[model samples]
Target: MTDQVMAAIDGSQFSTAVCDAAAWASLALAAPLTFLHVVDNHPQTAEADLSGNIGLGSREHLLEELASLDEKRARLAQEQGRLMLEAAKSRAIENGVAEPGIRQRNGELVETLAELEDDIRLLVIGKRGEAAHKASEHLGSNLERVVRSLHRPILVVPEAFETPRQVLIAFDGSKTTRKGVEMVAKSPLFRGISCHVVMVGAEVADMRSQLDWALMTLNDAGFEAHGEIRAGEVEESLRSYQQEHAIDLLVMGAYGHSRIRHLLVGSTTTGMLRKATVPVLLLR
Candidate 1:
């Protein structure tokens, strides 16, 4: 079966943008769009232990009431998820996705997406979820986890939607990043978009050669491609270039560095996702 463009929607400010961005991706890939809403059941999973209480009768009554309340809360949460999915489907339809599908699952977001990964061609999610709606400086707690757990490409969108005109690829000469460049070259998602491949490091001959290869590959694939080198921190240099060129979409490899290395310093992927005002497409 052809994989679908799956979008993770929730009751957050980013819902509209997520829908819009998913619609764009769905059209770009010529794939069906599916909106997935996960109802986290962690809060209501554990039943209270009312044993060893002074009054058995009172304990039983209290347990019954607690169980009832838990049932009610779970029902309410499911209903809310259903409503959110329906609304997202409507918005996606309005945004030019014909007959978008909606799914409501009861599980953790990362686990649910992993379960559905085989059916997803591209995964679109918000930069911040409902829990982090007001935390502008922080990325959604689930974002990194989802990226780490899933093998599929993920598109992390900001809270606002804007049709991407230019795309920036942060190249690091890693295997993952080279694959990302090739994907961009071949995928219809970035067709006809201006592409920039940049390396942030010392201006060495090898760095220049790598940038030239990226440019050549993109140009051969029929993209209006550009290449450059910057000297500074990876995240800051990329951000500055993106702003200067009005880049609406950013692409890079997801956690290409080793886990130990990142633990010692930090993950460039996390930093970019946290700071990028535009949508970021992370290829793993």
Candidate 2:
């Protein structure tokens, strides 16, 4: 991946938070920042075949009128996306991103992101988009698709953002999570921050061994790392620890062979993403 932090911005309430989170990440990682806005390909704005065989009558005129309306709608959508990108760029600049790049494309969000996945080091996006704002219980329509489609780490920010002082890793000792731990240890983004690796289950030999390994790995990297084995439901235990310790950032491995098989397959990962008030950094 290239050394750049890309923030997906829509004109929703979470746009400001996305920019702030992206700016924070860019500064922490010392990478260039880019703002991306996609004019979603909605069926209503799709091109229509007005030239199709229409009995020469008012129906032909109506089809032409519909096609013209679709064109106008598409133009309006493009303009709106452009304005949103400009606004997000301004916000990122104010938040200390020097000169953020801007990309406005007309396509599906997931497809656009997949096309740029190889060049993105990190992606920052809102937890919910304009379409899902009315449904607080749901994630953005494209969030899960983007996560599953792209391999880069994603920082999903809530409607508000603040620099994280404490990070909680929902460690499971799986290969994916182990890689995540290693990434956290080596990346400059989490430098000088308190890290807590938590595994939820009965305190057994295997669990203890993995926990110790994670601690050692992090400690070796010069982090103030702490390990814990909490017993209870996965989501509840993690959420409780996060609230009790005032954790500002949550880290997890996505689409692993562990419990996070598929993000939306009724797993703890889905619950955490749905209810998490803090920003979650998902590593794959």
In model 2, the runs with Cα more than 4 Å from the true position are 45-56, 257-266
Highest TM-score scorer: 1
Question: Candidate 2, residues 132-212: lDDT per residue as tens digits?
Answer: 855666887689888778889999999899999999999999988999899999999999899999999999999999999
- The alpha-carbon lDDT assigned to residue 58 of candidate 2 equals 61
Q: How many backbone clashes does candidate 2 have?
A: 0
Q: Each model's number of backbone clashes?
A: 0, 0
Tell me each candidate's TM-score. 0.93, 0.92
Per-residue error (Å), model 1, residue 106? 1.5
Residues forming the 10-long window of minimal summed lDDT in candidate 1: 257-266
